[model samples]
Target: MLKTAGDRPYRGRLAPTPTGRLHLGHAATFLRAQERCQAADGTLIFRNEDLDPQRCRPEYAQDALDDLRWLGLRWSEGPDCGGPCGPYNQSERQPYYLEAWAKLRDAGVIYPCTRSRRELRERVAAPHEEDEEAEPLYPPEWRPAPGTGQDAQEPGEVNWRFRVPDGERISFEDELAGKQSFTAGQNFGDFLIWRRDGVPAYELSVVVDDLAMAITEVVRGADLIKSTARQLLIYRVLGAELTPRFAHCPLIRDEQGKRLAKRSDALSLRTLRERGLSPRQVQDMAR
Candidate 1:
């Protein structure tokens, strides 16, 4: 059986990206997180994932807090309401991510990639437009020899990818999804931990933050199941004693059967509020 933080007092979190307004889907997922935390009589921390320098906006961040509050959800710790686990915002927690990068670097499990997107697409079997969210598998042939990145002092100036142990199966029992498994290189190849723009990627940042906040369970949309597999590797590489369990709620889709995104403004929590939808009504719609 996998060791988990189940024995610890439940520490759940609602980590919302501030690239856009929270949509109905986001609200539903966060509500699930809050519900699970409350069911366990746990502490709920709100993390603002506003690391995207190009897309994240102060207005969007504020709007996420406002919209979630309007939806009648409350968090004990967050960017607004300070708590012991602050600074709750990802933007303020770069030092923590950088520290993790250094640890991974020192462990010699990560390497620098200087290849551009065009170079990758031309070289590797890139995913098509339908799979835009999916990254092309980093070609194993292109990897520098082991110990190539040992001399680098910092992760800036190039993309850094964690070398996945190919052909190894990564399996975990999700509390909600149940009996999940994925192959390493086939499911995903070496993945980005730090981008060339000096920003820590999602895979690395979330793991570091969860460990730091002592998050006992990760509650998020089911769309992130593959991401969970990737993060599990990070946890092991970082020598995390007890990794959080997962509860993946089903994704909310639009009328077209497409998963809701930040672009789904009509179903955004802010728009729903302006349309006079009550908290109960929105919650019902989410259900």
Candidate 2:
């Protein structure tokens, strides 16, 4: 069983993808994490979610660290600090994910999903055009059955998906958004847990990491609210004690009210540094 919040020491993390340069959104989330940790007298760990090796650049990873440092953010331990979680990069933790995947496989909670992205898009779009605004479009038999590897198959041949429990509501109290819930088999159907390319899916990896790190609270952008249900399912499957408290803050939008993206904006930390923006100034802008 997973331990309750009171049963564990307070621990949080600032996990960032190194696929792009650090921007205002990144700074804002990190600042919030730092403040929250300070307020609670807890330790904040820094992790690089650089699993997408193809898009993740070494320079970008270094730049992200430099950017965080420039923002006056300090982590108690990280990849550079050589702490207990020495390898703070996700890429280095593939073995752990593999082990977790095997466990889920043995439990018969995951299944092979042959549907391609294009096929899934068409499935979702077809219902929309038909004005059938109902539940997610997944065949009943397609869902994985607990303790039965009926859908399990060789990797690279088919993608893996988690079988969500039907008619069950996965609900949690958000530190900021109050009560949030999603009907398991209805609102969300079986979802991918591993890619065909042998990469551990984010939904699975994050849950495994959070449990391993003993994180007490999770504070992220409100955009990820939908992901809560999928994550909670993983926690339940693992028989974790209790879900961590969540605080999904508002996202930083541009003048056009669009979420900021690295490709479309010149808000890279290096660019900001070149413009002579001090760490404090950047942090203030993030706020």
Candidate 3:
């Protein structure tokens, strides 16, 4: 039986993508995670979301650890300090991801996607009520018949997607954001779970890792509110008796009123520290 959140102690995580230096937006969101976890007297884990080999670098990962530490964030478990969930780095957790893929395959909820990236771009984009960065929905007419992927022993041969029930409304209550809702196939279509390049996609990996780690609450930026709706489907398909509660913190924006990105080096924690800013000063700036 999948572990239920009610039976476990409160557990939260700091999942940082090691694609670039940690920025003020990351600092604000992570600090909120620390505050919430401490309020519940819960354990906090540091997970290195370094699944993209081409983009992720060891130096960047090390920099994240250093920057967060310098910002006064502490965790009970992480890549640096061993814990029950040992391979805290996503790259090292492939076997776990593969297992979840197989279960999805067996359940007939996932299918191989032969569509290439270029072809998808040239086609009509999916109807979306989100930001331009949202992925174009997979054309429902292109789907292979149900059970088309059951013969594949390994998922790396082709990309795999979790088929969402079209037009069905997926909803969840966030501890911070409050009531939220989105319609499947409209907001998002069959989402990628495994890429043809042999990488587990973010939506799948986070769900598997969060459940495996027994996390009770997830704290992240508000931009991912739609992602939470998608993840709720995965939890349901995986037979999770109870899913983690979530807190989507507000994003830190730049002078132009655009949300901060990792490319904002001047506002990065490392850069701020280099400017002789103390941890307290940095925290205040993030606020």
lDDT of 3 by residue, 56-94 (tens): 999999999999999999999999998998699999999
Tell me the whole-model lDDT of each prediction, alpha carbons only.
0.90, 0.77, 0.89
- The predicted structure with the larger lDDT, 1 or 3, is 1
Better structure of 1 and 3 per TM-score: 1
Ranking by lDDT: 1, 3, 2
**What local lDDT score does residue 136 receive in model 3, on the 0 to 100 scale?**
80
Ranking by TM-score: 1, 3, 2
The prediction achieving the highest TM-score against the true structure is: 1
Report the Cα lDDT for residue 102, model 1.
Answer: 90
List model 2 lDDT by residue over 240-269, tens digit each. Answer: 887676788777877887777676447767
> What digit string (tens of lDDT, one per residue) describes model 1 on residues 1-287?
24789589999999988888899999888889999999999999999999989989999999988988989999899999999988998999999998999999999999999987778878877786545677888889989999879789888699999999999898999888898999999988999899999999999999999999999999998878999889999999899989999989998988887889999999999999999999999999998
Write out the backbone clash pairs for model 2.
Answer: 2-240, 2-241
What's model 3's overall lDDT? 0.89
- After superposing candidate 2 on the true structure, give the runs of residues whose Cα lies further than 4 Å from its correct spot: 1-4, 126-157
Q: Rate residue 22 of model 1 by lDDT.
A: 91
